[model samples]
Target: MAETSRQIPERIPVNLIVNGNRRTLDLAPWTTLLDALRDHLDLTGTKKGCDHGQCGACTVLVDGRRVNSCLTLAVMKDGAEVTTIEGLGRDGALHPLQQAFIDHDAFQCGYCTPGQICSAAGLLAEGHAKSTDDIRELMSGNLCRCGGYPNIVAAIQQAMAQS
Candidate 1:
């Protein structure tokens, strides 16, 4: 018979409400929320860019507020509600922001689209943007190397107008 592998004793227990589903995980103390989502939970929609908070490609919503997932520790967000790009939609339909992004051609390389949409969703929920400039200013963290800022802003504006 094969011997069982040793269990990691230092792993911490964490509970999360991810995409409206309860998830329990035993993670290392230093595991970032982004790694937990992508590696452990298999939710790769939350990307890993720069591995730092400076690049908002790893943005996700924690308890309805947008956060940089790369810098946040998994244990810190235990019991929190996390929403990734995959969970942004409902009832077999794309999210309004997602549809708006498509309509406005908000992406060039498409790498930053997920984070852009997630940030846009949180921006709308935050209700801090009153104009186009406000949206541009607020969404500065998420960067697209392909220079798609104009279209990204347009998508956000469209979603805002529809809402």
Candidate 2:
């Protein structure tokens, strides 16, 4: 008789409420929230730039606050509400900040758009100052290699003024 090999442990079950939808995924405990969102959940709006938290491209909102998805473990976020860039708009309508970004040409390469928008959305919600210095300070974390800071800041300021 041939001996059977033992099965590996199953992935841990986690519940993540993303973009107003509840998702159940079986993922490895070591999986980061970024990977779970991009790989398993297929929410690619959250870009993985540095993956070490040095770059803010993986930024998302955890319970309406900004966070680096790559820095957070998938298991740690179980039952938590996560908001990706995909969640920022409604049916066929862009969020005010999103439209502002487009209007201001905030991005050049566009890779950082998702993170930039996500971070800006949170910053505006925080009710910070509308000065260029404050906007630059708050948005410093989300870097654009194309040197699009001026446009990015303009977009945020425009949205803030309108709001």
- TM-score top scorer: 1
Candidate 1 versus the native: TM-score? 0.94
Spell out the clash pairs found in candidate 2: none
Off by over 4 Å in 2: 1-10
The lDDT, on a scale of 0 to 1, for candidate 2 is 0.92
TM-score of each: 0.94, 0.92
How well does candidate 2 score on lDDT at residue 153?
89
lDDT, candidate 2, 1-163, per-residue tens: 9999986555899999999999999998889999999999889999999988877999999989999999999999999999999999999799998999999998888999999999999999898856999989988888899999999989998999898
Q: Give the clash count for model 2.
A: 0
Report the lDDT tens digits of candidate 1 across residue range 66-98: 999999999999999999999999999999999
Per-residue lDDT value at 11 in model 2: 88
